[model samples]
Target: MNYTAEAPAVWDPEAFTDAEDCLLCADQCVVRAQHYFVKGMIEIPVIGGDETFSWGVWVSISRDSFSRAADLWDTPGRESEKPSFGWLTTDLPVYPATTLNLKTYVHTRPVGERPFVELEPTDHPLAVEQRTGISLDRVREIAAAVLHAGEDAQR
Candidate 1:
């Protein structure tokens, strides 16, 4: 299952005032040319199922880190690069607590695929779910939530 976010939580590229300073594309983002971010997938394996459920999220990286990732973006064997540390910028609504600012590691994937984001082991429900796995029912719940959210937006 693949559900992706268009941008980081609470940051609207459409409403951004400083167009010159902020950049938000489908895969990469930079705010004020200082705060750098990259889109990645945080996948949760389905219990007793062969597939996975993923949240298309963003991770905030440093300027140097972003530069390194950018340099390797189109280069072959970029997946061989070590995972870069960053903070999770997406806010997931499925959990009660805020999902923002969690520690994470972003691993570059092969060409045409977004990076993979692994959250730091923590007591948070999302982290626990990532460490372990979620149920098919959980996936249905997430799907229903997302569908309703999209419907709400259209209203």
Candidate 2:
């Protein structure tokens, strides 16, 4: 699933906040209020065959979390690394859940350059969703649904 932009999708702050329940907190949380949304694809190698599939991915996270995670990635002799918190939704059959560490296997360039995040190969269904292409509208819809589901679960 190559990351070709299907259509432009605007961020609905109100819907996102409602689904994420941002109002429940006394103070603003970076993960809920501020984060980077991105879409991309990864090539997966198949065993015993010369075949590969382009897996599309959708992710969002705050700069603070990304920086903190990057610091941890560089730090030596660290007891344990903190998982950079964020949303990791995707369009792959192997992945179903939409919760993942946004910092895992990430890549980026200078300030003026475009940022991209790569998903690490894992057997666990971590932050994976069954879908194709990179549609901001689809991403927003999924986020809304997931967050809304969370909100409903709490009620």
Candidate 3:
């Protein structure tokens, strides 16, 4: 299912204990107080086949992680890059019970405006399950609960 943020919310960094873990990390990570637009899961069907798989989706505006990635993307003689948005998705499991399967990508504009470019493949799953035909409201509920759970864990 497709998602679009009507009124995005900022996730306070202080709400999470591991907010600093993203810093200097090799993978693209989301920071606190960043505007998260969409968060949900989708089931991907194999083309021309009956096989199907699930993936969790997270989309947000660029923050510290994006800046770090852009800085790293710059070379001695190459043009500087500025990413404005980020998209992260869980990978299809090789097995149904695989863990820590996710990937990240970025773009110069909101995902609603332009496509995102792959920054790097990641393996940090949010422990969310993929469900088909879920409503946007339900997705938001799940996202909120996940964030709240993180905050509670930090406290």
C-alpha lDDT score of every prediction, in listed order: 0.89, 0.41, 0.38
Off by over 4 Å in 2: 1-33, 64-87, 91-103, 109-117, 120-122, 125-155
Displacement of residue 140 (Cα, Å) in model 2 is 27
lDDT of 2 by residue, 1-155 (tens): 23322211323455555666332221112234445544444444433355443444544556775455445443444324433333554333223543344334434433332234445445444323221233445445545665676688699
Kindly report which residue pairs in candidate 1 clash with one another.
Answer: none
Q: Which stretches of candidate 1 lie over 4 Å from their true place?
A: 14-18
Candidate 1 lDDT tens digits, 25-106 = 8888888777899999999999997998899999999898899999988888899889999999998876889999999999
TM-score per model over all chains: 0.93, 0.35, 0.25
Q: How many residue pairs clash in each candidate?
A: 0, 2, 1
Task: Report the lDDT tens digits of candidate 3 across residue range 57-77.
Answer: 444534665454445443443
TM-score of 1: 0.93
Candidate with better TM-score, 2 vs 3: 2
